[model samples]
Target: MSSAPSSTVFLASPDADTPAAAQALATIRERVLAATARGTPLDIQGGNTKRWYGQTPAGEPLDMRMYRGIVSYDPAELVITARAGTPLAEIEATLAERGQILPFEPPHFGPGATLGGCIAAGLAGPRRPHVGAPRDFVLGAVIMNGQGQVLHFGGQVMKNVAGYDVSRVLAGALGTLGVLLELSIKVLPCPVAEATLRFALPQAQAIEQLNRWGGQPLPLMGSAWHDGVLHVRLGGAAAAVAAARATLGGEPVDAMEAHAFWQSLREQSHPFFANAPLMGDGQPLWRLSVPPTTPPLAHSDEHLIEWGGAQRWWITPRAAADVRAIAAAAGGHATLFRHGDKLAGVFTPPPAALRAIGERLQHAFDPSRIFNRQRLYR
Candidate 1:
């Protein structure tokens, strides 16, 4: 629901000066054009930190790590443009210096996580439900299509577009549509205050409380339920956070401990994730996206409820179809988030009409099927 601004000054070219980035860009175009002519598929990669998140990569590796750096950043405008290979950590540090942040709260997974990988995966942190997804903050993107054509969509300023928003669509596409070269995203000022409170409750009661609180005007930033306890984070004005804390009436977590807890959850490094069975024949971790208002799901005790019960993570040995069916019945979808059968399809199968539309879009952008073939779907 965000748009680019109508008029804005063009900052320095994102690919300027860096000969390596320029070479990489030119090489990608040349390789893409040749691949298109010869029907050779290409697998785009940046940082490689998220290689295990989606289907197994195919085709020749096209490394994008060398093409990186902040293209432009206007603190006053609350926007930052960077090459696709720029490390996300660097961007966060830059924003921190300006007292701003990427509100979507993308996960780094590892030290090598890059901006392009973040966008490609489109994985948001706990703040997602309160703020928005990575796609919502995307203002513009420069990409190379299957035919090696360089195309630009959207721009630096919000409210700048009047047509189809292809920039946002590129998000979570897993490189099937094209090779991302650069991206521009909107940011926001850092919250003045933040606090986390924990309460011991059953899963059902936790879900109810979260949904109930969600309806109010409190400055809720994040929430999660695990180990027979519900943890809620509040952020905004100092007075507001304090008031909400008093009303919620839970044990206040130490400031330092709360910060570490959120970071662990964001990076999936917490013990809960570590203890989950690995991807082999054992139970694989499943991510279910359901409505927050939905009650505790069957076998829900074994799950970690996040996003105020909207995103549930469970490790189960059940078949993909069975897990997906349960999610679908609850008016949501399930994804084999990690350590699953990639060939069986990591995501829930889309409906016929949606599948057909996705096919059309894929063919339109990559007629030769030379980019990450079968990455998102078979």
Candidate 2:
């Protein structure tokens, strides 16, 4: 375990507090207010790396890359606050310098990926199941609502809350709720030691084995199955990793290869994703998230099972309804992760009650519906 320093560290340079940064923020707020007054929609953009994700962006672009930098860091407290436009790589590198990390392992789809976009997309990597999701790490946020008023939620530290944690709400809201300004996020110590093991097993056997091991006190940090091979990553104290490795027998994977494999899985740069057709091409990539215990769905080639079998990716030309039905039947949902016919919808529709709640939240946060309108729902 890692501990924070007694006092918080102000990571911002003079540049962060300079008039330029302030002016950038003011410019964004003014734009929002002007858009609201004129009844115009604003497409909130950060890096535009994931611009193709979710519904098509509407309204005039509100570029956010200008307002960026780390605001503060508390290593002992394991919290970091930064402007929404701060590059994700910068934050990760900063955390890495101190042997800390965002445990959820967010994916940077492109070099230009930003903190705001990471939260908006809310996509986690292979380590998610062993740790948690993006929402789980969010401590607080500063956002500009439809009225252009900045609203703050949560704080620098974690505590029990009676109602909705608005900070977490913004995690996957796709900026539909408001304009993400700055965010405080919880981080964790990087594993002290790590290793990957390989197993040859069928999908059913792999799922069963992973679930079985999941119930045990193993240092399982990441797991993935593709092309009849299952790779499990063990991380923790050296003794713990060694003990787990000895207990769970599998061929050892080279350290560098293991790192590259997990990175590929995290970035979706693996051959499975590479082989998938582009949006207008023949086939599209689909991500099916079901219970870890759920049996494998009937699917064709070029598929990868990850998160201990809870998150599966497949490349297919299947109908949207058919793919969604399969996931729903398994008590989960399917997302057209990339390169798909989005007119049929990229995400499964929320149930009526959930949809109603979302609608209410949207209305409450952006009555003018001026912020990234229909980015999530549509």
Candidate 3:
């Protein structure tokens, strides 16, 4: 598993700001205005770990790390707001103190991961099938459009639904829509009890069992099947976990090992991913999202399935078109996740109607097309 250094910096309160942070915000606004005036694009950046993702960035770098700090956090209300540049480690540490979490289990990828980058990437971990995705938890956001105007959408409380859809749209826009400034995200308390079980079943059998169990009430937190074993995690109330554990007969896994194993999967440090760099030349990591009930695709030695079969990861030297064709035939799309010849394409192109809607939104939010231009598409 990949072990990266953890960020030790404790973020300051949202209400308090150092002089340097104020200057950073003002400087960013100025840069946005100038870029809009010149019709030049600005490549919004954070941490730089995920730079390899998406299309090749095309614009002057706009570092967001300078504008950092928590804006507000109310543990009782289960809500936290922080600047886009605030380090994700800091936020997680703060939330852990209150026995709460982001629920979506966003992967850090690297120690320098920032809130803005997390929202821009909009990736969810193993728990996604149980709880929700990143966009679902986003309560609101403050964004700076191409006109250098700051726009606010949604609100802190869950009941505040006005403009909520607009706020959620910024979750995975990759900064193509606008520069994400601050975000208010809903949080959830940590589960009271948790347990991990192991079932030595083949891929097809595992998928069938997962889908069957998915229909009944159970505290299914996360699941993964690779090689010959399927691992399942149960969480929530102690009684519920125990009841489910008794019902689902399987070998038990040590608590510590289970935590580490799940963490490895969330951070993409599992053995499956750790071997990606060594998967031979031209081999790229492909993420396939299909119906949970969809049968397995063509077998590969490096295949790993997660999210109850909804998300599958495979590394192969197959041509991009061939890989996409297989995924499409299975009723889903494919993403060129990592280490590939992206000249062909990183994401499967959206349908015409979806593409048109995206264009209209881009025009409405960034008419100048000066924010991370071509980052999401050509």
Whole-model lDDT values for every prediction = 0.86, 0.87, 0.89
Model 3, stretches more than 4 Å misplaced? 1-18, 277-282
What's the CA error at residue 48 for candidate 3, in Å?
1.0
Residues 1-378, candidate 1: write the lDDT tens digits.
Answer: 123343332366663547877787888888899889999889888888888777888899888887788888887788899989899999999878778889988988778889999999999999999999999999999888887888888998998873227899888999889988899999998888999999999989999999999999999999999989899999998999999999999999999999999888888877788755333244588999999988888874367899988999988878888888899999999998888676778988888998898889889889999898888876
Give stretches of model 1 more than 4 Å off.
1-11, 14-17, 162-164, 277-282
Clashes of each: 10, 4, 2
The stretch of ten residues in a row with the least summed lDDT in candidate 3 is 1-10
- lDDT per residue for candidate 2 within 1-378, as digits (tens), equals 345466766677423476878898789989999999999899999988888778788999999999898899988888999999999999999888778999999988789999999998888988899899999888888888988787888887887342228889888889999999988899999898999999999999999999999999999999999888999999999999999999999999999999999999888778777766333344678889999999878766568999988998888888899999989999999998777688999888989999999999999989999999888766
The CA root-mean-square deviation of candidate 1, after full C-alpha superposition on the true structure, stands at 3.6
Estimate the TM-score for candidate 1.
Answer: 0.94
Our tally of clashes for model 2 stands at: 4
Q: Give per-residue lDDT, candidate 3, residue 371.
A: 93
Candidate 2 vs. true structure, TM-score: 0.95
lDDT of 3 by residue, 1-378 (tens): 112124322335534567887788789999999999999999999998788779989889999998888877877677888899999999999888778899999998889999999999999899999999999999998888988888989998899998999999998889999989899999998998999999999989999999999999999999999898999999999999999999999999999999999999998888888656423354589999999999878756479999999999999888899999999999999999888888889999999999999999999999999999998877
Best by lDDT: 3
Candidate 2 residues lying further than 4 Å off, grouped into runs, are 1-7, 11-17, 160-164, 277-282
Count backbone clashes in candidate 3. Answer: 2
Give the Å error, residue 234, model 2: 0.7
